[model samples]
Target: MSTNFTYFADMSRKGIFSGHIQAMVYDRSKPFNSLPLLPPTGIEEDVDILKKLVSSSRALASVDGKVQRLPNPSMLVNTISLQEAKASSEIENIFTTEDELYKAVSDTIQEGQASPSTKEVLRYRESLWEGYRRIQEKGTIDLDGIVAIFSKIKNTSGGIRPPHSLTVIRRGQSEFRAGEIIYTPPRGPGIVEHLMANLLDYLSDKVDPNTDPLLKMCISHYQFEAIHPFPDGNGRSGRILNLLYLVNKGLLNHPILYLSKYIIVHKDDYYHHLAGVTQAGKWKPWILYILDAVEQTAKLTNQLITNILEQMESTLEHGRETIKWYTKEINELLFSQPYLKPKLVGDRLKIASRTTLNKYFSELQAAGMLAQIKDGREVFYINRDLVKILEG
Candidate 1:
């Protein structure tokens, strides 16, 4: 909590906290116009943290830009996207086993045909790719793009929450009596749209030249989450926006450096830092937390990329040494889909028949390069080492 950084509390209601809405009900009118804080001052620690964030951002950008040079970079994109999907969805308590997720990925065109958990994870990946495509096409971010991201995550016709929607942040496993409200976001016929408009400006070149783009991104994330624009999918959407904003600003060439797994591991601090800003005007801690997440997740991702490359090399070597024949194309296919199918493998290697591809899978499995797992009656062969690396 910073005594110097000043923040005004929106004269919002606290009934969401205690679940008592009689005389204690807050009118819920917290105006947030803190977007263009020129200095964003009050925290003496921000200078150092900002420097660190700049360096860390560059370090991440280095590998992200170089990873594209790899032979099969989409492997990282798809694998990282799915890992991020799983972690981000896990934050919402949507759980799926590793086997279930990999098998779901092996399925070609897995939109509606999956268990609820697996389907939801796949939607996150789909929406992320969609968001990436939109940003690439338009070279800008918009509310509709975000709506598209969330709609896929929830698999619905999604958009901003309507003013009449009684969407309050709460946590529980039951009905109205399940849990007390943690926060009540602004409610109005146009509050969400209005806030989002201001957010769009900050994300672009029109505002706050003094604040670094990365700093602006941290502020943007907090603002988006605080706005709670949608009735559902806000968390996943906000996270997707984080990466889009980075790519939009050219901080990352790809979305491989997502912070979901890191945030999931430090979820307590993630929420606490956000709450610290709202409760006591503590901006430095929140800024530092996000910067730290960027730094740490970048390191992990760089290492993951390194491990992936090394494993690819080792797999090639092992195949050539132990088997009578070898093809880098075949191994690339296996890496492309961690859970490999004979049809997918055949398509990649120009083999037409499943009967013939089965021989290849058997050879790979026999050489200790692939492991077979049966989802039901259908068996799926996977690169055991690669899957383990991805599951990390």
Candidate 2:
């Protein structure tokens, strides 16, 4: 459906625009003190948004349902959350390899030995889990919860940016207009808080109760990025907030949707749509892009989960048929993560006898279920199939 320019016209009357309504102009170099508030009218009635919303909601619900059926949902949570953390960080140009991430998670290397980028990525995962727990306990998302997320992500005790901080979103060094200001967030005393309070109210349905939760997510995401409350890590924090918002609205049981992968794939379009909202008040393209991200990521995640489950079943069948020491407990432990250490396996399985533990590993390796890797004195088994699915 098509929405007239009334929303922008109303916003202009409210002082959101710096020039005539026809031009819809605003200065990008200055703090955007007049940024419009949340719950833009007419979004719920847009035909294109509603059409995409149906498929997006269905796809998201499918993921939630499949995760609930797993014997150990936390296993999938741990794996998928890390993947999300990695991709989200990469969006900000913080890169880390899968090997480093899995190895750090498995404790095969010392914490201090992990690269700075890997540590930051781990912190992002920690922030995600912490936010999940807080939402579960509080039954609502609040300013304190958001601050906690940003703090954990950057490993700082700092809260929102003070009025003095001059923050501006800029282009990357590789871009043609590198270092040029893209958009400056709303600033000045009480301005950020005012916008954020409206955002929180919108999330709680205090602004508009009729809007669908999925649609609210799309709108709130844009508002959060536009607000840009924090000095750094706003991108990562906003991404985490997307998942938590889904869980808070009951559309997701756990944050296992893998949404960032789609964003990474369409990185340029992602930024363009975000800018469209701020510059020209183009909500349809932005909302449609987010809806498509949810739908595509949910489908990809379902397939990935299916592949992992199938691999687990195949591994169990192979072990039961070929290895004499196979057990359901061992199989589950092996699939808990892509990388497994001998000590970790022995400890979890209560196999105190080194000989017996070694035999189990030897048989699994001999059965082609696991590949042995030796790093100096450290030895670990790699679930090749599971890693491939996750990496894919």
Best by lDDT: 2
What is candidate 1's lDDT per residue for 60-147, written digit by digit as tens? 7776766877897777788878889999998888888777888888876542456898888888889989999999999999878988
State the C-alpha lDDT per candidate: 0.75, 0.87
* Residue lDDT tens for model 2, 123-221: 999999999999999999999999999999999999999988999988889999899998999887666877888899999998887789999999899
Q: For model 2, name the residue pairs that clash.
A: none
- Per-candidate Cα RMSD to the true structure, in Å, reads 7.0, 5.2
- Model 2 CA deviation exceeding 4 Å by range: 1-23
Model 2 poorest ten-residue lDDT run:
15-24
Task: Give me the runs in candidate 1 sitting further than 4 Å from their true place.
Answer: 1-45, 109-113, 173-178
lDDT of 2 at 276: 86
CA lDDT, candidate 2, residue 28: 92
lDDT of 2: 0.87
